[model samples]
Target: MPTRRRTLLLIAAALGLPRAGAAPEGGYRFQRGLMGTRFMVTCYHEEGELVGKAVAAAFAEADRINEAASDYIADSELLSIGKVPPGTPVRVSPLLFGLLEEAWAQAEKTGGLFDPTVGPLTRLWRESRRRKALPDAATLAKAKAAIGWKKLVLDPAESTATFTVPDMRLDLGGIAKGQAADRMLAILGKHGVPCSSVTAGGDVRMGDPPPGKEGWNIGVRNRDVDRNAAELVLRNKAVSTSGDLRQFIEIGGVRYSHIVDPATGLGLTRPVSATIIAVNAATSDALATACCIADRETGRKLAAAQGAEVFLAEG
Candidate 1:
């Protein structure tokens, strides 16, 4: 393969939406961090009495849902699902079942291009990164074969997840952000907050738009080559981009992007960057990765067909 320039997915998160001034009140300082990202929920209620109760309940719910969906911990229900014996009928929470359904939907829509079962490949890359050495083609193929979204089975009535293939596995990173956004929005609504915003790392959800602020002004970085200068703004939506150049290996005039192609099981040689703005954060994240991995022209076409506004910095 002639050395192809690997593209980097340049993503930006902006919550610059404007609305009426925030009501003057003291909302609880709701804060927590997990999976290397911080979540903050701030809201005001009409009845002061409900704020505390609502927040407390919401936090508890968030914690429970997070525990069930997170892939970072070994004991998380997700890891258990991926590691447990197939067809064992392990129980899963309602929220987790919802997340799984959404993930499966995305996988189907993206034609398996936005696979959540990419955990094994991601881990192998992580190991290679730690060792500061690239995996041989054979090792990459081994890990790739072990990863596939199609190999997982879901039962809606039973709320059970099973791995059809012994080595098949999943990681919920793509769906977690959107789930968090949805949960936070639910909490905000429950607390009677007319408007609010929730941002966890790059995933952002807005209730009404911070008092007097226009729609959130999201900024897209120009690869590792530029700074905050290049930004894109959208209204009432979330944007996500996947980049390969961010942390990649450049060997012998060949660049290996971190955004692995599900079909090839190898880092993409094309350096296409995709920016997708959609109704929710999870969709944006998944589409961003899928488009970048699919490369520029074809990925952009797929994104457009999905009703997501697409922006590309073709590599």
Candidate 2:
């Protein structure tokens, strides 16, 4: 086998599948680092070469999504929306337009708790975390002023996005990975690899169960413990976990999570983990973040309204 093929086949062995056990017989796994994290695709197919091609195509699709929607990328289509003059319609790719549509719908469903307009605040908190301090009142206030889901206008007919407020950046960190994983899974299915799972960080989108298994076994981690708090068996569904478990910083002996609550314009101070299971990865991913920011009862209600389930754990 060539070096590239060897590396693709070795990803399954080297990194190991998350507590889901080995891929079924005739399964092929591929992994690559994309969008600031590891993206793994495992598919069961009779032909090894075909599996390799399908996984490669899936990764390619993931890369495309990252290029189109990444907030971290200076020239991404998503960031380009911020560069346009305020209130000017900026035509975007159909993919980005559809994604923004979904995000807008999710924001409305969650009553602005899942706002993509939280980008300004996200950047501010990111800098604060790096410096091990909180943003000053003026800075936080400025960021908050730029937020508000209503300020985003999506014209479906023109396939454009318009920002009504200046500095109205969009951070899709809470939802973009799920969308990428969903697209990768679709790519695998189109390639005749239906029994597959795409794992992008904490987001997992499963297509069909392994050859003999009833469903994929996914482990949900607790906020405080190293071990998984729950093991779920699911198929043809998506699951995402968002929390401060590992992504947090301590300032003045108080820990703050990387997840910023749009309501407060600051990272969440409470140690909580939110897991959302829904029909698709994007819904689950965004809901997981919203659930983390909401109180337990409200979180459950929020997920339930969207035909999703929420599991909340606090340390």
The model with the greatest lDDT is 2
Model 2 whole-model lDDT (C-alpha atoms): 0.86
Candidate 2 residue runs with Cα over 4 Å from true position = 1-24
User: Under the 3 Å rule for N, CA and C atoms, how many clashes does model 1 have?
Assistant: 16
Query: Candidate 1: where are CA atoms >4 Å away?
Result: 1-32, 40-62, 224-235, 245-255
**For residues 1-315, could you state the per-residue lDDT of candidate 1 as single tens digits?**
111101000000021111212223333334556545766554544443354455555556667767887767778888887666665666788888888889988888889888888877777666755666677888887778777777777889888887765656677776677667667667767767645556565566655544455654567753555565256544457666667646686655667777777787766777767767777777877788787777567687777877787667655
Local distance difference test, each candidate: 0.65, 0.86
> Candidate 1 at 1: error in angstroms?
61
Q: Per-prediction TM-score, please?
A: 0.78, 0.92
In model 2, pairs of residues that clash are none
